[model samples]
Target: MKLALSALGLAVLTGCAAVSPQQGVDRANDEAAGFTQGALNLARTQQERDDRAQKTQTLLSAPVGQKEAVQLALANSAALQALLAQGWVDAAGAAQLGRVANPVFSFERMSSGGSLDLGRALSFGLLDLLTLPARQGIATRRIEEAQLRLTGDVVDQVTAVRQAWVRAVAAQQTASYAQQVYQSAEAGAELARRMRAAGNFNRIDRAREQSFYADAATRLATARHQATASREELVRLLGLDEAQAGALRLPERLPDLPKQALEPQAVASLATRARLDIRLAQSALDSASKAQGLGVVTSFTDIELTGRRNTAFDADGTRSNARGWEIAVALPIFDWGGMQRAAMNGRTLAAANQLEATVRAAGSSLRQSYSAYRTSYDIARHYRDEVVPLRKLISDENQLRYNGMLIGVFELLADARDQVGTVLAALDAQQQFWLADAALQASVVGRPGGATVASPAAAPAESASAGH
Candidate 1:
């Protein structure tokens, strides 16, 4: 009886929503519709944003040269926004002055044998007079460092936006190629089906062709999804929303790699001088070095200034404000400066050691960047010169052979597939190389600084559309 009931339950569930043609198609269509609606909404927002972006883009017309990818990134990037917020802190701090709280006041009265006597006094001494200048100097230096660090952050964030923009373009191109290949495969599959109907092709050929067409279609859809994802990523990086980022344009090609001498030392120095992290560290080190003097001078030493007022009771018990000043200094009889000096010296040395280590690490990173830059630049060059040309030749040859009847239709199709694969590979190689080049610049010059300093000689053509 239990087994029969279980079988009935399974039947009811399966009858309603079994994973069959109708159910699967319905689900797929629903998901596709959801994605389509989302995209349409995003497009609508984009149109609105484009209006504002156009004005901003106009200001950058000369620099970006109508490059949509760069225009979008410059308009949208959040990395830059973060840096800008951080910069506000520096700007605010620069105008700020450090001030100590005012001294406290208190009064007390006591009853004596003859009459109640009141006490009153005034005093102002906690941190010594010598320390204020030193402290203020420290604060002022910190402000300078903050400003420098802010500048570095701006440079780094701008570079990151540029990098994201370039990647979006590469991903767009890749997806576009996939789309074309899928369309061609679909056409070929349709032709093969017609041939099979006429009895010129067997069932096996039709099935294989159909499979190829399906595979290409799947790949194309996947590519489209990824391209959209990449674009979204670019929008987020640029600090745009669905509304603000929608109107941004991206360039079809990446910015050209600058041709300059890649010196390890020079690059490392730039990082040390410009990177926000290094500057922040340097400020910490400076603060620590100055703090050492406090411990040695403060041990068992009481430096105080005092003012007192006392009233005298005579025959009539008269009251008067009699004030006097007194100063006292402690004698460091026990500990002396031994332990304090030792501690201060230790901290000072530790901070110095850390600064040295950081400098060395920055240098090593620069060297690594140099190596990667050279390797990627070489590979990118090879792909453009050799791999791309060879793929084109093979594709042309296959077309000619098919026309001359030197190869079967199947062979021609195979060659076309191979050519597509090779071209895609070449494109990937090119993107990788350029990305590495950008990374190399990031390592040495700081991201934002690199973009500013390594401006491309002439911007690439702004020929890309939202859809290929």
Candidate 2:
């Protein structure tokens, strides 16, 4: 009885304990902060969610910048909240798997000729109890995997927000230039009409001016629509309502290019430590290895042990007691676990291959991202330093010639229109560079955003040549 009592005490103490999902969530938020530079959280209670909503309101109350936009999404996005809640459920389910199956209880009674007998039995899976520690290890690993996955998801979301902000702001700037071009064309067309009425301009020349005005109007319309569409895209990502969208204000232009491009060596170094894909793959491989080992014992056979007790009373008033235990083992005669073992082996092999593939691909992926980053930087820089300045100089010279009566008013108006087009192209180049920059940052951190570098806008010289 003493031995049994001691064993019972040990079993009770060693039983699996419940794990809180907050532990994993907190870990994920911490790791994600390094990449997103914003707070990520799971609002488990109504009060917590309300608090986040209030914070989101505060952010949207002002003109939202890129960083502020990320914060707003983190606070306001229902989808992100759902991801967190689902992550908790997944982690809790994994914890439950590590726990021992509930024990079975049985009771029996018999009465005959004034004799009474009772039996009680309690049973549980013996093998599961023996392997509880291994199962717990597997569960821990699964929780880590969940945390890493959450971090990766946050990184992706934040990257999207940044890129969306860039596009919206660039579109706004482009639309302004488009409007200027339209107004200039309208003025020139009106002047041509008046000159034609006075017999100073021919019909062909007047029609050419009208055609330019018509094209400018179309381009202006397209640009305005593009700006609205991009702004709405940002609004959706940030989870803003109509009122909040109205309050949102973007920068006048895209940010200037960085002073120096990221070095290839720096990118390679970050990829080695920061790649989440490789980390996830490695975690999966570890999980498969642990699972395969655990499966070997469970697939072969199962064991159930039961501690039983009985009592009996006779007609003469004499009482008796009985106590014993039973062990039930599954026999491996008719069905062996060949298929189970085969599946386990296959899973292990697949995991190994996946890890290898991720490792091999990581460097190449970083290299490609870096190439885009560098190329975009160069193109945008060229436009800023070479193309825009030359256009400005040419416009200045044309203005001077017009003042001297060396060029006609039509020639001056055309030059002004061309200069606006050059500015529009420059804005596009700047937007593409920033988008590429955001994508490169995401790739450096292990969640590849798959950012594509848009082709650089045609140079003003090229446009002039093509016209000739």
Candidate 3:
């Protein structure tokens, strides 16, 4: 009875505590500070909503940078709020497992031939009381798992926002360049027409020039549409309403690549601490191992204890009272809980293997992400320092040669046309570098966003157009 009272007191203390959604959001903000930029919130009131809206507006008032975009999404996204709420719900459910069910009370009364009888009983699950401490341990691990999941999910969401912002800004930059290319092609085509009419340019050369102009127009249209699509995608990820969508602005260009790529040792150091996947898997294994141990006793049978009191009265006004305790154990004669024990064993084994798998894969995934990052950084740097400058040099020399009358205007125009592909390809390389950078940030935190490299020949088909 003393032990029962002690366990009941423990259960009462654990049961009365409430789980707060803001707590989970705050935890995520702390754990995923790099991804969330420490701006995560869950607005449960009108005041908070207004404050969040104002913050989002302030962010959208300027051209959204990569980090600012992630901050805005954390502040404004309803889906993110739902995620926090769901995490709270999961945490509460896990906490519920640590508490014992309320004790049951029973009452009965009967009268026969002026004789009266009354009975009362109180009952509870004895197994639940005995296992309270173990159950609480399991609940603690599950709650930990929930928090890690919340942090990992926030990291993924913020990583997506960052990548989308990069794509949108890059697409906007490319579109502007495409427009410039189209205008230049149009001018060259008109000049070619005039030269051909004056009999200074051949029919085939004029046709090629016109074909280039047509292709440029097509490419410009595609680029504009691509820009629109990318911007809309960003808007969606940021959870913008119609007014907010209209007010959205993206940077005119992708940010310049870092001067130096992250060192391998630095990356290893970053990934070594608090990786979400490994921690989550370890939490699962802990919960499963604890639950399996508890299941060994619970799966075979259940024990219930009841305290009973009875009273009887005769017609002569005499009364007698009876009091005792009863212990009930479930009979496992026909159906033992073999399947329940088997399932628990299987889950424990699965969790152990999963932790091992995550441990083995973590380093490899980080390496792949780093490789993509470095490769992209190198390619973009090569274009910036080598290919683009070489193209500009060629264009400038051609213009000087034309001024000296060593080359015809047609040849000068052809040289300019050839430079278009190089410029666009350089833009593509820069875009991939930024995207890879975003993915690498995510992978370091253990949420493996892919960082696939674009092919070297990412320029449009018109870049390969024939030149005379």
Candidate 4:
């Protein structure tokens, strides 16, 4: 009786030792502090919800930059909330593996020939108590895996918000430039039409001006739509309500490029530090190895123990009492648990190989992400320092010549169009750099954001041809 009571008490204590959902959430936030900026939260109560809503509202009232956008999404996004909730569920389920099943209770009463019999039994799985330590070790590893996964997920979400903000702001700047191009084309076409009416311009020149005006109009429309689409994408990422969306404002332009790009040596050092991917893989391998060992004994057989008490009363005023226990063990005659052992062995092997693969690929992924980031930064800097300035200088010279009557109005208008095209291309280069920067930030922390470096010259070349 003392032994049985002791085991039951131990099981109850083990059950109480599992981590609570709040603790899991707090752990994830701490581990992902770089991405979350210590702002990750789950609003479980009305007061929390209201506080989060107020924070989001305060952020939305400003021209949301990259960091503000991430903050807004953390506070407002329903998808992010669902992700945290699922993380809590996974952690709780993993903790359950460490707890023993509740003991079963049975009762019976029988009457025959003026005699009554009463019986009671309490039964539980004995192997579960024996394997408690091993199971708890596996549960601890699984919980660690859950926390790392949540951290990686938060990094991914924040990277997405950063990239979307870049796109939204860049699109707005591009659209504003497109409007300038349209106005320049409109003026050139109008002047050409008046000159042709006065027999001062040729039909071919007038037609060319009109065609350029039409093309500019089309480009303007496309740019406007692109701006709208990018803004809406940011709005969705932020999980804003209709009212909040209506109130949302974005920065006027993308941030300027950093004075110096990230150093390769610095990137290498950061990549070598503890990464979420490597930790997760190691945790998985540990769990599989633990579980494999645990299955060796459990798969072959199981044992159950039951304690019982019985009392009987006879019609002749005679009574009897009995107290004892029962033991049940499963036999491995027809099934030797061979298949179960094989499955466990296979899982361990797979986990080992997966960890190796993750370790091997980590450096290469970081290098590729850094390459894209550095290349984008260089191209954007070139445009800002060389291309845009040269175009502006030419525009100024043309304006001076036009004022001195050394160039016609048509030549001055053409120069203006070329300068606007160059500026638009510069805007695109800046946008790509910001996107790549966001991706590199994620990759440094072991989550890749898939941003790539695009050709910085493509837009400007196309623009030059269109102007001609």
Candidate 5:
């Protein structure tokens, strides 16, 4: 009896202690910061929320870099906050499931012929108390799964914010060049019109120049809209209010490509170490296995232990007290829980299969993301080292020729326009490289976030002589 009472005391102590979700959230935030170089947090109080808002305001007060953009999104995004809050709730619920149910109490009173009786009883689920340890293990696994999921989600969100900032800044850069191209086209068209009036240019030639101007105008309009759209997309991701949006700014261009690309072996190693999806699957499998074992006993039978006491009075003024204990067990004579066991078996099998699938997919995803990262880096470098420089050389030569009266001004203007176009293409390549960089970082942490690299825009084919 002493041993049994000691065991019950231990179980009650284990079950009565409240579980906190903050620990899991803090672990996830720390892991995410290690992987993504950004911090994540849950603002559970008004003070925390206010502090985050202040930080966001400070970040938005200037031209935000890619890292700053990620920080801003982490601090300000309502959707991300909601996800964190939900994760906490899920973890708390899982903890609740690990605890034993509350004990039940009952009372009764009866009176007849000057006789009175009083009774009291207390009951609790014996099976739940006995299975508390196994249930707690399952709950722990569930909490671990939630933390990994939260880490993966933070990776995804930070990657998205980084990529969006890249596109927005790149769009703005492209739009500026497009405006330059438009101005050059307008000047060339005006010159051709003047030359046509002076009978120095043919009607066909002037029409061609006018056509180029029209195309340039249309391109400029498209570029402007693209810039606005991409900027708004970033704004939404950062969860900026109207006042914050007004203060938000971005760098004029994407950052330069890194000197060296990430080695595939290193990336693969990191993916293997930090793959949250695989960890989550493993947790699920473990939980399923434990639950399956627990179901074997629980599904077939349930036991409730009750302690009772009563007092009775007779009409002759004699009183008596009675004390006893009752045990209630669900009889499994009719149903043997065969279907429940089968379901548990099926769940275990599914969990095992899912774990295998996640493990297999992790390698493939990492490889694909690395490939995109390397390819985009190469393309962007090529544009920076070869294409833009070549265009610049051609433009410089054309300018010299025009100064020496060996080339027409129209030729110089057209060369300048083509140079701007080439720079625009290079800007686009840089953007793709940065985006791929962000995606690869996410993939390394086991959350593959981006798809394919964007193709570079084609340069204009018509030379300056075509308008002549």
Candidate 6:
């Protein structure tokens, strides 16, 4: 059954992903057919993804002095450090497991001459016979589990940094807009106060203009504070100290969000096909099953080989040599069959429970992720299509009314404030959509919208890991 599942794992729940792009799926299949070639294809795909990101950066207007932040994050991020340690542990474990246990030997001696009595001794030269294999299997599984977890962590951190970058840029733009509105409001308020003092207008006009200026000032201050906080967050995430942060430049632009969006079913399929947490649990079950087999063998089989040496003596003090070999097995009678069975049963049960838990947790997470990603996508789309356009129309109308003197200067300033607010809100909506995108990609197997990664149970999912 395990072997059958192993084959089925690579095939997916229905033997293939229901939502994968045909070209990428075909490419994955081709890679599956040839080990080295498959690796080459993956490498090529990754390089292309990197190249695209680099190109995209040139078009975006990011902050200045962000280099120090990047350098710091690369050096001090706890997530990255933990990942590196896991990789080293995995390497040592693999080496130990792959290596063979040294052979065993036994020595024998005769107690007396002319007597068949022999001396028996027991010693284990290959104590590694058990520890090595057991430790190796555990290590290999650890590597897979670690790699999967680390991949998700790194992706999460990257997404976080990108989101902060997006927000920081938006905040700066908002502050710039707010200041513009404030300047116009101040001018209008002064004009209205003069007109009221000269008996040309009522106090209402002057008061409204002053209110507009106050509102713009509040918003501008808020925007400045937000930008500052976001900048600091980016720097901290990049692992820089305060001094290094001071030397950093803000990003010039943010990476574009994945142009393509996944449907709910696609995200669900992705979670199942590529989620490493689930794979790690499945591998643990396999390791447990293997351990049960070893336990069963140990409990039943008392395997031993013995040797003896003896000398027959005439009435003389000289001894003649004799040697013999004997193989022995212990007959089970009072030994703990129930205890062995109990232990094996527990291990097997735990394995089943673990796999079950992982599948359930992954399914639940997928459902939540798909919904959030879809919601963000739809909201951002709505802002772009409906809200932003309406705000712009309002602004244009306000401008015309001001030109015709049908509306006062305060009314025009009000429209300007609203337009700036709408743009900032739209920007936030869009950035959130990208954050959701990062999460879904982390759940999947690679950078967003590029390739299909499939986890096959072909020989235990643990064997299908990278940097392990």
Best by lDDT: 3
Listed per candidate, the RMSD to the true structure in angstroms reads 21.7, 3.2, 2.4, 2.3, 2.7, 14.8
Q: Write down the RMSD of candidate 2 (Cα, Å).
A: 3.2
What lDDT score is found at residue 190 in candidate 6? 81
In the predicted model 2, the residue pairs found to clash are none
Q: For candidate 1, which ten residues in a row score worst on lDDT?
A: 34-43
Task: Please write out the lDDT profile of model 3 over residues 1-468, one tens digit for every residue.
Answer: 864895678667567434677777888888887777677887889999999999999998998888888888989998888888888998888778888878888998999998999999888898888988899889888888888898888888888888889889988998999999899889999998998899987888888889889989998999999999999999989999999999898778888888899999998888747799999999999999999999999988999999899999998989999999999999989869899999999999999999999999888889999999999999999999999999899899989988998888777777887887888889889989888988998899888876799886455444333344
**Number of the predicted model whose TM-score against the real structure is largest:** 4
Q: By descending lDDT, how would the candidates be arranged?
A: 3, 4, 5, 2, 1, 6
lDDT of 2 by residue, 1-468 (tens): 865784675467345545576775676666666554546777878998889878977886777777887888888887777777887777777676677777788999999999999999888888988888888888777766777787788788888888999999999988888888889889989998999999888877787778888888988898899999999999988877787778788878777888988888877776648468888888888888998999999899999999899999998889999999999999999878989989999999999999999889887777777888888888889988999999999999989998998888888877876776578777888898888888888888787766667865543321121111
Provide the lDDT at 122 for model 6. Answer: 33
RMSD of 6: 14.8
Q: What lDDT would each prediction earn against the true structure?
A: 0.56, 0.81, 0.86, 0.85, 0.83, 0.53
Q: Give me the displacement of residue 342 in model 3, in angstroms.
A: 1.5
lDDT tens digits, residues 197-270, model 5? 99999987788789889988998999999999999999999999998998998888777788888888777666
lDDT of candidate 6 over 1-468, digit per residue (tens): 743563354234222112222233233324222211222111125675465334324322244432323323434454444444444454344334434333244454444444444344332223233444564565455444444444444445555655565566556655666667668767867887887899977665566666766766776687689878877776666555565566555544444445566876666554436455666578767766766765665666555544455555554555566766566666777885669878878977987898887677665665565666777777777777898889888888878877998886656655665565566666666666765665565455432322122221111011111110
Q: What is the lDDT of residue 301 in candidate 4?
A: 96
In candidate 6, what residue range of length 10 has the lowest lDDT sum?
459-468
Point out the higher-scoring one by TM-score: 2 or 3: 3
Candidate ordering by TM-score (highest first): 4, 3, 5, 2, 1, 6
| lDDT, residue 247, model 6 | 58
State the lDDT of candidate 4 residue by residue for 1-468, as single tens digits: 786787778867587538766776687678777778778888899999999999998998888889999999999999999989888888888888888888889998999998999998889899988998899999989988887898788888888898999999999988888898889889889998999999988887788778879888988899999999999999999999899999998878787788899899988776637888899999999999999999999999999999899999998868999999999999999998999999999999999999999889888888889989998888889988999888888888988988998888887776776676678768888998889888998888888666578865334222222221
Q: Give the Cα-based TM-score of candidate 2 against the true structure.
A: 0.90
